[model samples]
Target: MKTAICYYSRHHGNTRKVLEAMAGEGDIDLIDVTTRQVVRLEAYDCIGFASGIYGFEFHKGVVSFARQYLPEGKPVFFVYTYGGARGNGAKTMEALAREKGCLVLGEFSCKGYDTFGPFKLVGGLSKGHPDAQDLEDARRFYRDLVKRFSGGAQA
Candidate 1:
């Protein structure tokens, strides 16, 4: 299946790190929403939304990109990074995808080094996160998604 991952990774690039690891595992197209605002998703069998948590949600750039570009009835997955252990980043993205008629496959989330706002005063939260282990886990998650999607599973 032709897969594409549309991501917005700013600040410490935590989300990108995980994505790169996933790419190493298999062939996947990575599109940076910050640079490329418009992309044709019709050709992709599987699509992924990825971003870092901001204010307890997925980055606005990613959200906007999905809202504007995601096609109906496509299989979708999510990958996100957050400073806090608890966040609704993926949930919000899932809702948007569903609203657009995309089928939710699964999601992956992990802690990322964060120094946004007050966290910066304390030298950051979840420092050194999205570490080697986290990246490996993301790769595993991608592999699982590939297997599941390729098994003739419908959205």
Candidate 2:
């Protein structure tokens, strides 16, 4: 299946690192919403949203991008990175995808090296994250996603 991973990874590149692991395994299109102005999700069978958790949610750019471009009835999954443990980080994206008639496939979240705001004074939270194990886990998640979405089979 043709897959596209649209992400915002500027804070510490935690999500990007995981995406690289997936790319190394296969040919998947990667879209950096930080730079790209337009994304064509209609051409892909599955879409993956990746971002560093910001203010308890996805980066605003990604939210806007998906609201404007995600194709209807497509299968969608999420990949997220955060300074804290996962909670409802994917909730916003999931809701939006569902509103647009996309099937919610699942999500992957891992801690990332973060020193944002107050944490900067003490260095950071989740330091040295998106580590080897985290990447490996992400690879496994990607593999499962591929198996689940292969050949354009609907969910």
Pairs with backbone N, CA or C atoms under 3 Å apart (clashes), candidate 2 = none
Instruction: Tell me the spans in candidate 1 whose CA falls farther than 4 Å from its real position.
Output: none
Candidate 1 lDDT tens digits, 1-155: 67899999989999999999998877789999988655899998889999998888888999999988899889999999999755676988889988988889999999999999888999999999999899989989988888888886775
List clash counts for every candidate, in order. 0, 0
Residue 125, model 1, lDDT: 93
Instruction: List where candidate 2 sits over 4 angstroms from the true fold.
Output: 151-153
lDDT of 2 by residue, 10-73 (tens): 8788889989987776668999987866667889878899898988899888998899889889
Candidate 1: residue pairs that collide: none
Q: Given candidate 1, what's the lDDT at residue 89?
A: 63
Please state the error at residue 126 of candidate 2 in Å: 1.1
In terms of TM-score, the best-performing candidate is 1
Q: Supply candidate 1's per-residue lDDT for 132.
A: 89
Number of clashes in model 2?
Answer: 0
Q: Candidate 1 at 112: error in angstroms?
A: 0.5
Query: Against the unseen true structure, what C-alpha lDDT does each candidate score?
Result: 0.88, 0.87
lDDT of 1 at 127: 91
